[model samples]
Target: MTSLPEDSPPLIRDNDRDTAVGRLQEAYAEGHISHEELDERLHQVLTAKTRGGLQSALASLPEEDAGTTSTIAVAGGRIKRRGAWRVPRILKVESAYGTVRLDLSRAVIEHPVVDIELQLGTGGAKITVPRDAIVEFEDLQTGWKDTRYKTRRRPRSGGPRIRISGTMGFGRLKIRHARR
Candidate 1:
């Protein structure tokens, strides 16, 4: 039921959303839309599959004032935070090796999940998860590099569930230092 304003900036299209994003960039450069507005509208532009679909797309983006905060910060990376709901701590990451430092961690836990996304633009990335939790996972992309995390020995008790997903565009995903 949500609709774009009659005067809303003509609207953006899926194929043209990129161009619209560029215009938004110009708008920001000219001090038209605030950073917050740009971030929000950008979300709409990306989520929208088509020009007409943009109205709803833009509307669905999480507002700064909204309870939840979701953003895609990098050139080819998007970080979406959904529901601080529950669970110890969950970090879903999508990036290349250049952001590997952001991926490494030294922690032990009963239940922990580290979701990693690798792109061809990436290299040497690994995730460290506690060995206490049960391990249950599936390969998103079939390949040797994607199994880097599977190299670790799973704990005997129900086996900690560790899920590692990879794509041809990415390098390798290794799960290391999983404390038992």
Candidate 2:
């Protein structure tokens, strides 16, 4: 049998297509692209067969804000965020004697990578990440309780990468992916 041509383009996967679509949606939501442009780009992303084609579809979109950071600190109370919130590129959360809950399932995440630094003392934390998110907590240090997380062996391709690091003292940290 004859060998295949070397010039053939690399095929694109479903997850890659989903990622492009997400970027397009974000650009549209941020007013970087008009409705018509979003439609056109979305169509291109849906029909693209190769990585180059996908890149072309995402061309000219504004880059995400990579320098933005937000901090949430509580000395003796609960800190919670959920429901359509805007997620910054870097987030620092500190709790001295209360619980911290962060629900990112419905949040608008503009960046592809997000960093979360947690410092907890005598309080627990429950973090619900987006369904497609890839979580990394290798740099976290625990005191009395080990973090509760069901690690994914094969992370999805199109979701944001959440990097979590910091210290937890005498409190448990529970992390789960969103169901919906």
Candidate 3:
């Protein structure tokens, strides 16, 4: 079989495509991409078919100086990630006595799927994704805890996916769809 373009964007759904376009616009506003480059990249983002494709469109632009890992640890407070934020490849969520929420409705996912490691104690966590997003819950070690997956039905293709693996203690874990 032939190989796909190295710079090709990952196949994303319409929602992800729209979010990627928004990020391209932000890069333009931040002077990371020129007018022509923005236009070109926007086109690519709109038509990207793989995660690499979208990433290649912005490969030439400056990126956020954030840390490599995405982590949220809560002992007694709430942690929420919303709006057009970058979705890390690997995420770690820990809660001891508070709640953690990861909203992927408007997130800019860098990969076709993300691995989330969760550890909870006397607290809860919730993840909200787009209606069409796919979610796979892995082996979870829970102690008197409740876990619920309320996300919409998984699509055959094009949508982002999340794989969750971890443990919980007297806490609740839920995966739900965004209220569009």
All candidates' TM-scores?
A: 0.37, 0.64, 0.58
Per-model lDDT: 0.46, 0.88, 0.77
**Residue 20 of candidate 3: its Cα lDDT?**
74
TM-score of 1: 0.37
What is the alpha-carbon lDDT of model 2 when measured against the actual structure? Answer: 0.88
lDDT of 3 by residue, 134-162 (tens): 78775677788667875455454567767
Which of the predicted structures, 2 or 3, would earn the higher TM-score when compared with the native? Answer: 2
- Which wins on TM-score, candidate 1 or candidate 2? 2
Q: Which runs of model 3 end up more than 4 angstroms from their true locations? A: 1-67, 151-156
Strongest candidate by lDDT: 2
lDDT of 2 by residue, 45-124 (tens): 89898999999998888774456899998889999999999999899998889999999899999788788999989988
- Count clashing residue pairs per candidate: 15, 0, 13
lDDT of 3 at 173: 84
Which structure among the candidates has the greatest TM-score? 2
Better of 1 and 2 by lDDT: 2
Among residues 3 or more apart in sequence or in different chains, the pairs in candidate 2 whose N, CA or C atoms overlap within 3 Å are none
Candidate 1 residue lDDT tens string, 1-180: 998878665544333664455556656766767899888777877777556765443443333221222222344443222222222323334443243433223333223233434343554444554444433346456444545544446455433345544453445545554443
**Model 2 ranges with Cα > 4 A deviation:** 1-65
